[model samples]
Target: SRFAYVRDFELPDRLLPGTFILLRIDGHAFKQFTDAHRFAKPNDPRGLELMDHAAISLMREFPDIILGFGQSDEYSFLFRKSAALYNRRQSKITSILSTFFTASYVMHWKTYFPDTPLRYVPSFDARVVLYPGIREVRDYFSWRQTDTHVNNLYNTAFWALIHQGGQSKKDAHESLRVRFAWPLL
Candidate 1:
């Protein structure tokens, strides 16, 4: 049958083995989704806790995960480069990671927020990046941590201006722009 030819289009290419693989997954449209669901601002303890639980579940379910690092709505799962899971196919790896993480998040959400039902569907996107050496992996983690720290500071300041300083959203954003313009000493 001519229609059966469509089934053969699946692409399969094994990623090169023998390198550190980092699969990072990030929430899609999380800001608006969080706002619609009324998540607490600055940092949501319940949300963060849910993320941690999901990451732990991933590590337990897949023994190949060496470590899991997460901040906010994103998590990075580290796997030994030698793992042959899914034949090291990029599409398979990324799709599975994203789907699994999203499922975990949804499954754990009710435990954290019992009364609040998920108002809408949630999803995550994932990518696999290879680090050739220990130094690059170290730098990658350092960079992620630094990024989280700066974002936290900026968000904290932004929210403080609204709550404590009694400034409007626009004003708070403007203030942040000016305050963060100078480099840290």
Candidate 2:
């Protein structure tokens, strides 16, 4: 017997062709992973190199990817506004790109870090967001880059206080607050 059709079945959402698409992927529990692997603080040359290699592979694999920006454990891929890949399906686009990047990273891990074996398979999550115009997209990326810089500064200082200055986590945070004249706790 055939089942009855349901009205509330999965709804379909299609990204408009004229809008720019950004697919951002981030490592899952990357902080713990980094700590376990003893990744160099502030910047890990080998880790960055691995991410770059994976990104390059992603670009080469998908011609629709216009540009990519990556720092630390995240990468954002920019697709042309007119791209019709996978019929501009948000779920398909994000899932495929994220999995592909994770695979590439795993495949090239050895090339970057020979001594440290991958303890477990790393995974990533992705989301696709649309921007109505090029200006908005540009501003969006500019904002992201600026935030990255600011966060990097904070993290670098925090780690320095812990490592070099021999301060506890709470003391380091308080020190940063006092040094920067930040009133909020």
Q: Point to the candidate with the largest TM-score.
A: 1
lDDT (Cα, tens digit) per residue for candidate 2, span 51-133: 99999999999998898999989888899878998888778888888888999999998888899999887888889988899
Q: What is candidate 2's local distance difference test score?
A: 0.86
Query: TM-scores of the models, in the given order?
Result: 0.90, 0.86
Query: Per-residue lDDT tens digits of candidate 1, residues 109-174?
Result: 999989789998988878999988889888888878887888898998899999999999999988
Estimate the Cα RMSD of every predicted model relative to the unseen true structure: 2.3, 3.4
lDDT of each: 0.86, 0.86
What TM-score, to 2 decimals, does candidate 1 have? Answer: 0.90
Candidate 2, after superposition: displacement of residue 61 in Å? 1.5
Instruction: Report clash pairs, candidate 1.
Output: none
